[model samples]
Target: MAKTLKSAAVFLLFFILILLTNYETNNMVVEAALCKKRSATYPWASCVPLVNDNSCETHCKNKEAAVSGFCDTIELRQGFIDITTCYCQFNC
Candidate 1:
């Protein structure tokens, strides 16, 4: 019984760790996308809407511009993973 309990506890801990890791990864992906999108549209004097805002559909009409901007940003291209780690540390 004690061995079974220990095994169950270990399994539970690993399961929680996996869940948290997955959540963090998903958040990083979303953040990267948003940063790319914002960088793209914020130039050219356009008003970019927040992700949850209803205007996002209209705001993202120029996705190519945003993607191009994302590609050009050295931080996004070279240090994206580190940036995501820092962001996660602060936000999550």
Candidate 2:
């Protein structure tokens, strides 16, 4: 009976260690970006020329990880400007 109890205790300790490791891994992923790329600024808005500047900000706030978002414009060609790209910023 003592031997059996010892075995059970060892198993319990191993299981707890596994649980703690898993939790750490999960936190690491969340702290980083979804693809393991940690960036304060990210383009994360609906790409549309007519989108409002602050529209992306709202979208970023909706994300569980995103702290904020902004809109930016890019010039593709002469007199051609593309607008409506929201850059999302995470707390991490």
Candidate 1 vs. true structure, TM-score? 0.43
Instruction: Give me the runs in candidate 2 sitting further than 4 Å from their true place.
Output: 34-92
lDDT of each: 0.44, 0.64
Candidate 2 residue lDDT tens string, 1-92: 99999999999999999999999999887767564343344453453435435456666787535776666676677687654356776664
Those runs of model 1 whose alpha carbons end farther than 4 Å from true positions after fitting are 39-92
Best-fitting candidate, scored by TM-score = 1
lDDT of 1 at 36: 47
Ten-residue stretch with the least lDDT total in model 2: 35-44
Candidate 1's C-alpha lDDT?
0.44
Clash totals, every prediction: 1, 1
